[model samples]
Target: MAQRSRVRCGHGRLVALAVMAGSLVMTGAPGASAKGAAGVRPPGDGDTPMCRLTAGPFQRQVEKDLGLPQDGEQSEQDCAAIRKLQNTYGISPADGYAGLVSHRAAVVDWATRHKATLTGCAGRSRRLVCVDQTHQLLWVQQDRKIVFGPVPARTGMPGHRTRNGSHRIYRRVEKFWSSLYDAAMPFSQFFDRGQALHASYRPIFEDPGSHGCVNLRYEDARRLWSMLHVGDGVTVWGTREGA
Candidate 1:
């Protein structure tokens, strides 16, 4: 959930509801972990068996990305490899299912590794925060050199889609609480209206997306907060998949 006014506010009511719904759906699933953010369970929660090759929607892409047998089918090897990617990127459930979040995570990681050739954001002469909604990633660059990220990010979903354009950070709060949504928006930095780049307690790879914000991992957001100033330029481009 997100805040209603300027200055300080929480994440978002819709976001909290989405997270709650996701948690409830997985509450009793096998290998669920209750210690995840907001009581949502992670995949490798406990003594879960290995090679739970549940067929995910993005099975083929994940298989191809991991250099597995590209048959678009699940297997023990696919499960293990996909789960490793999920764990490395902090995707919840780590269940070895190549769902949308998992697929996006893999794609972002690939983009990060090859960011030297990626294009979109301009202003190489000055500090810029680049948000690529198409790939669901963000990074900082100055004088044509990357200073931070190419990190995984989650942007607004279909309806509350994040606007693409040039904006500047206008406000910041280390620990913002949204009374409207009753959730914490840690390291909130407002760049456009109520939309900011902030840390999400929920995994950033979760579905339904943020409420017109650029959601980042806690560590990523903290690092970004330290690197970006109040007036740093932010340029967002591309279209979010479902938006």
Candidate 2:
């Protein structure tokens, strides 16, 4: 009888686990890669599904579980905070998009729990800010107060899409690709490759394109580099729709 009781307990545990898994699937959590009957991806696969619906308790739960920003939309401040992270850390710019990291769930949870507006801007920080290329603006904030700018910028082509996501600053190279550091100023340690914030003069207003890098005024690039630390945030959003 004792052995039979133990077996029953183990069976009960299995049932509980199954129930939890089912609940997660029904709620549309990330990592639930199970396809539908028609081989189509689930509703929550790409964008943050919770944002589409009205902000409420269910959305709060999803945010807590997934770490995303909540409420109706995304914001410029959010972009800046993510950008600061990307510039400071080594995370890919693509990772800044809403669904790339697990922390988005946490962000969502915090927003909901506090009854705060989900501005979609990552968060407020003295050391972080998001750049929205679509609007040609930079969202800078500290301690929740915000300042906006129509900063001049250049963007990638359609396929490139300026790599929307979070990344961190790993290194700062004064003299990049040349022996003399004085002539060329480039922030060499960005993204995973040759792209960086460097001095360019082909045309300031025109979108002078790079392979996948950000080109800035020499002074602007240096100033930004100086302002950031090794672990600062950086996010690059390609357009206004928060794509």
Candidate 3:
């Protein structure tokens, strides 16, 4: 049996069933019941909800989210526009979402407030890692161009605020268990004394952040670890200004 979705969305709130805050979980792509042009599942082939706005993934998600009639055809050009929105918002291309047309509009509004500025990283562009604390974003740049990401980040809490200054990656560890906090810090790139850029599973999006570390998602940490090396320059700046 094919499932149908009724999205009661207003003012950016989606009152839908079985949707995670940052992901969409479905047994099959939404509208999986309907077959596409070549009788295929338009966008993705996974059971996961990380939708990338490309030819296959974007179209598939639209079909499911919009319940588009069978035999819908989406051009790569149209998919490219979605990709632009994802990039502009610092959203991962693989972020899963339904009803992309509306989501795209929502992201624009959200990004206007959340996107961090990078111009403060002056004179430190040589193999640099810039952490925008205000927006919880991190990036690796070379020659004034982003090489890796302005990906999501989870920083330290009120008491143990992530240090705000410039430093170098002093160490690298594949698997580190923190004796002080009794937590696991994987793919750690230590810059400050005990603080690091690592992968954490401690509900980073919620309150009370790490003990001064810059925490990233598992995959983001891995990508950073692979791209950065020991002795790379790191700059941490930008306060939340008002509230």
Identify the leading candidate in terms of TM-score: 1
**Per-prediction TM-score, please?**
0.79, 0.41, 0.53
TM-score of model 3 vs. true structure: 0.53
Encode model 1's per-residue lDDT on 1-243: one tens digit a residue: 343344322456665667756743442243322112312223454665344544666777877767788777666677678878978886665667677777887887677678797789885338899999998889998887888888988888777788899998888888777665666788888888878898987766666677788999999999999988888889999988742
Shift of residue 58 alpha carbon in model 3, Å:
28
Q: Give the TM-score of candidate 1.
A: 0.79
Each prediction's Cα lDDT score?
0.74, 0.39, 0.54
Off by over 4 Å in 1: 1-10, 13-46
lDDT of 2 by residue, 1-243 (tens): 111111100112233345434533332332222112212223343752222111222333334333446442333333334334333322232222233221323332343344333243463345555555554334344454443222344445445455677665555565554222122335443543434554443332222233345555555556666656666665667552211
**Cα displacement (Å) at residue 69, model 3:** 29
Query: How much is the lDDT of residue 208 in candidate 1?
Result: 65
Give stretches of model 3 more than 4 Å off.
Answer: 1-118, 240-243
- For model 2, what is the alpha-carbon lDDT of residue 60? 31
| Pairs of residues at least 3 apart in sequence or in different chains that clash in candidate 3 | 30-64, 42-60, 43-56, 43-57, 43-60, 51-96
Residues 65-101 of candidate 3: C-alpha lDDT, one tens digit per residue? 3334323444333344444444444444333232332
Cα error, candidate 2, residue 133 (Å): 1.8
